[model samples]
Target: MQIPEVGEPAPGFTLPGTTVRDGARTDGEYALAAEIGRTVVLAFYPGDATPVCTAQLCSYQEELDDFGDLGAVVWGISPQALDSHAAFAHGSSLTFPLLSDPAGDVVRAYGLVAPGIGLRRSVFVIGPDGVVRWRHVGLVGLRFPKAATIRAQVEQLVA
Candidate 1:
């Protein structure tokens, strides 16, 4: 299936995740409607502990403040379980929420599933009104944006 086009409402998700900072397993229901008043960044990756994914996630973690300042909530999603997510969170010192979509529900909803792999590297920028404002599907052989580029996008969206 083709990727969800821009301007579409981001598919909502509610999945169980373990709180890394507190060591508590909890359900995180991330609905587009719930974030209607604030921008939401759903960064999907293939897996945790991998090099490319690590770099991508770390970049997101490093820019948490900028995103927050723009009134945006960022969530990292992968097929990994809560425990793996917890480890990835702790290992990378991630400050945002890392959601576990073990059953690929969210992935399929967003049409981000790679044919032979898992989740593809994609970023969905859901505007404050719950409409998708921007999306980038993988670096795809180009030197995709670093933290600065993403921050710029957030600033532009909130501006």
Candidate 2:
């Protein structure tokens, strides 16, 4: 499946995930459709605790307040189990949710499945209206967009 383009409706999904709340790991189902009226950032990474993925998510966590100020919620998705996500979030002190896509269902839905990598490092910013406003899909998983760049994209949506 081709990735959703900017101005196109983001594919909706509900995935079980783990999030850090008050320094505790909580498990729940996150539904994209439930976030319809809010700007959402969907970040797809290859795995949890990997070097690049760690740096990428931690950087986003550092600027999480800025994203919150812009009314955007960020979600990290990977083809790992919930236990792995919980451990990664706890070890990394990640406050945002890390969704478990063990079957790669959501990854396939977003057209981010890579041959050996499982999933590409990608980020999609969805506007409050549920349309994709900006995206970056890494051909090589070594790098990812900076938090400021993603914030700017969300800012454009609300501006």
Number of the predicted model whose lDDT against the real structure is largest:
2
Q: Model 1, 1-159: lDDT tens per residue? A: 457787877676676655455554454655557677898888888888888888888887888888888888888888898778878888877767788888898888887777667767888888887778888887441233576777777788867
User: In model 2, how many backbone clashes occur?
Assistant: 0
Instruction: List TM-scores for all candidates, in order.
Output: 0.87, 0.98
Over 4 Å off in model 2, which ranges? none
Model 1 misses residue 46 by how many Å? 0.6
For model 2, name the residue pairs that clash. Answer: none
Tens digit of lDDT per residue, candidate 2, span 14-55? 999899877788899999999999999999999899999999
Question: lDDT for each of the candidates?
Answer: 0.76, 0.93
**Best-fitting candidate, scored by TM-score:** 2
Model 1 scores a TM of 0.87
Candidate 2 C-alpha error for residue 106, in Å: 0.7
